[model samples]
Target: MHAPPAPPEADMLRDALELAPDARVRPLSREPLGSGSVTGLEVTDPRGTAEPGTRTTGVTYFVDTSRRAVERETGFATGPSEAPDARVWLHPADPHLPALAPVAFADAASVLLARLGLAQSGPPVFVAYRPGRRGVVRVPTATGDAWIKVLPPSRIAQIVGIHSAFAHAGIPLPAIHGWSQDGLLVLAPAAGAPVAEALGDAEALLDEVDALRRRIAAVAVTHEARTGLKRRLDWYASRLGEYDAAFGALERRVRAAWREAAPTTVIHGDLHFGQLFQDDDGRLTGVIDVDTAGIGVPADDTAAFLAHAVASAVLTPAPRDGQVWALARAALRRWDDEAGRAQGFRARAATHLLGHALGAAEMREDERAAALLRAAASVIDQPAGTLGAT
Candidate 1:
């Protein structure tokens, strides 16, 4: 069994507004409290119990740079309505769980039911919400009706940009009717199964992803201003340096990247299976989470795609949904063949591999970290690739 966290950890260290000036405290539950699971304790005054009246459903708490991490595992939850303070809440389940949010707001997901008016209601289930990227919710819309989405793009210009690309491609994606700067997005749910559950074979999924890629390519912005050679090297070095001490050789590797001549292109910076939606009949319907779509090196898209590709491999039990090396190679090959960049895919893939490698090292799974390092090592020795060898 895994060891328990230390005592007095309290989990939370500080609050943004000092608990909004002490009138509130970051709500948290300890391991001992909830069957060894640290759930957020959303309470009312005087008494607490989990009943229909006392039980709060359809609520989630978001913990980011902005909110306090009251508990190590769970953070602040959304009350009946969105708020910044500790108040009485009646949340059905945690929004941190994918399907929880969708289920909670099933009544409010008005646009979804109307769009698929003819279809049967898919009881969308909540799979594990991938932590680092976004909380994903998988629902059954029709036979496979479902949707997968990131909260929103507040850090960068990701969501709006991708939504526009969907429109340009004539692809049917979720309609972004409501969005907040903090990444809270209220989108029109898609009618399909999560590609994760719908597709039976990786080969078929890859083909669908490839076709989807080409369609998006039509509307891709080609005139993106490339950073000059000197500027590029400096930028690489600066970020590498900032990350080097933690990464070991990243700083040195970035310094050498200055000499490489890599081309750039437009891509959905992050794309893969998780962003995809498929019908129960195996028809891939819509792909959401396109904000990372932008003009960058071709390999950037490949790396992002492979990130999900690798994740799929880890998530699936039997014959895995995909393998990292094969999927990455295929995505790269397609970018080079149809997208017009010969070396761009290789260079960007190498760059993405490095970034993903560093982050992967911190994962709890030793094998995952090892695999990421091995793949990244293949490219790291290339001037700009100086992070380290696996």
Candidate 2:
């Protein structure tokens, strides 16, 4: 199936950037940012660079779709100019995330690295970035590698405190080397390979997760983190329905199955194989990105982990796909047998799966989004006990 048409803002952005008429504009990624959206693009000029004949390779650019946001933080809108009435602005200058430009660019980031006692050897490589929210950049340091987390200034203290609490409680989270006033947090790299790279025994992995959950429960913190997915169901439904009407029916079923559980324990708001790492001995040794670590329902974490496993099975390519599918099946069976409320657990898992589908749709990954939507439907249609039976 053909992907959804690019937003009209894309053309305006191309004009603002002043690319050749035949420049190839491909979307790298996209996500919702407050009142609108943020899209990352790769523009390749057919006419080539300063040298003749050789085509210009892709150049990255970000575009924000909210005029109100651009107006609110006009000082940060430092990219190419748009027409006075345009709703979008090309960004290195995200309105809500002023820290992004400095950290994403090498020269300015070097100053921040100096403060953390690290020398920048090369340009910062963005590990992850969510337009107006937070970003993680991998920086090459004199000693080795360090990661800089760019967050809203107000969130720095809360995240730092959470890291400290987790470390004091013996969780193997990354060590905070230092932080700057503008919300650049320098972190020592965590040890071990991500579980996504080397998924060992599924049951053994769960054992470690359960143990970690218990330890997290005992650690005290002031923040209360919740998934907030329940509140955003309508938004996801609406956005997805723009691509396919079936998403509307899917949302109804998910809402009907939803049940609010009391926040009983401290849980990782976003738990998945990617967030976990295991040592050479196949032991869970490192847990990174605890930004959402605080009070929450245990099932949210359980469902998140399971949902990601299933999504990976659907999206992962080739030989590794079979192995991941096996892992997903094992995880589903284990969680289903152990869950106190099987139906509720399935409902929550389906909700998480739909979230993955929404992200795929936003990125214009049509086929992948359709597959994920099917995965979600299966989760909702089958009994938890029989979900992974196939």
Candidate 3:
């Protein structure tokens, strides 16, 4: 079943602050973090301001989408008995609350950069942020422009290790200058714009992605790497909440179809053009955001790339003439030919596309969103080669 709407913002704030009645909280800012998950708030306290200019700390509220309940600890951790850094869980009372908090990220970036000796006089510009997942910022350093990344404590090692392995395997990656135990990483920028910018040049995009796939495939799927859910089925199962009964059925059907054994390789758990950086001259510069990288069937990454292309085309007006769409289809076909698992590729892509449609529908209620949802449904049962054929 789908979760209920979020709670009220004012009530959440009142409840959260009530826990620390003595501490004067000046809310700096708030914004939405995606995945239908938690929201972040940047708050300042007048009492015992820590740094010279830094007065705010980030408060993240975890939303249990399945229960529509905010956890209790964070909600109540602000009392006089609790320390400033004590974690708390607070449930929001309404849907009008802030979804994301940039100030918190700004503070974090500032502190981490200073520690790394990469600090600049100016503030860091945010590239992306998700409350509990990750935060990315672009800042200047002595050597050159660098990126500061903050991720969940659990993912730090995997990300660092994967980048090292990819580099050793001859796959391009951003240079990792340093990382902290707290999940903060400093990196040198990868050359060129994202692959999404060059999707119109089908030949270049295909050649680059194919080469990327081959190199990644060369890495053996280690036992430790495959520790978690080894298939996309689990990922698909987690997203069925937004769709209707028909989608749920389609999901099950796709899952059943892929019961057979399939070839496995080191797959980019989250593959999309945004994750790919490419040069203007038809070459891949690097791959970023490997938080979900793991051992999986080759079809997983291919499906993810195609799904995002369709979602992008559906949501935007550019990449017209079906150029990007055609290129994505061709790429998948080539992979299937080489891997001998075209059917698996098509099936998994179909499942992911369906989820993307549901997300689009929920996120934007416009005609474009509607069209994409319909497009996804129409191709749900079709072969992978037939995707975006319309």
Which has the greatest lDDT? 2
The number of clashing residue pairs in model 1 is 27
Q: lDDT values of the candidates?
A: 0.44, 0.73, 0.56
Per-model RMSD to reference: 10.3, 4.7, 8.1
Query: What lDDT does model 1 reach?
Result: 0.44
Question: Model 2 off-target regions past 4 Å?
Answer: 1-32, 35-88, 337-343, 383-390
Query: Per-residue alpha-carbon lDDT of model 2 for 258-358, expressed as tens digits?
Result: 77777877887888888888888778888888888888877778778888988998877877877676766666666665443543666788888877887
Alpha carbon lDDT at 139, candidate 3 = 75
Residue 43, model 2, lDDT: 73
Clashing residue pairs found in predicted model 2: none
lDDT of 3 by residue, 161-275 (tens): 8888888887788888788655667888886787776565765676777688878877643633332322334543444444344456655656655434354677776777878
lDDT ranking from best to worst?
2, 3, 1
Over all chains combined, what TM-score does candidate 2 have? 0.82
The alpha-carbon deviation from the true structure for residue 176 of candidate 2, after best TM-score superposition, in angstroms, is 0.6
Against the true structure, whose TM-score is highest? 2
Point out where model 1 deviates above 4 Å.
1-165, 172-214, 220-247, 254-265, 273-286, 310-325, 331-363, 379-390
Candidate 1 least-lDDT 10 residues: 29-38
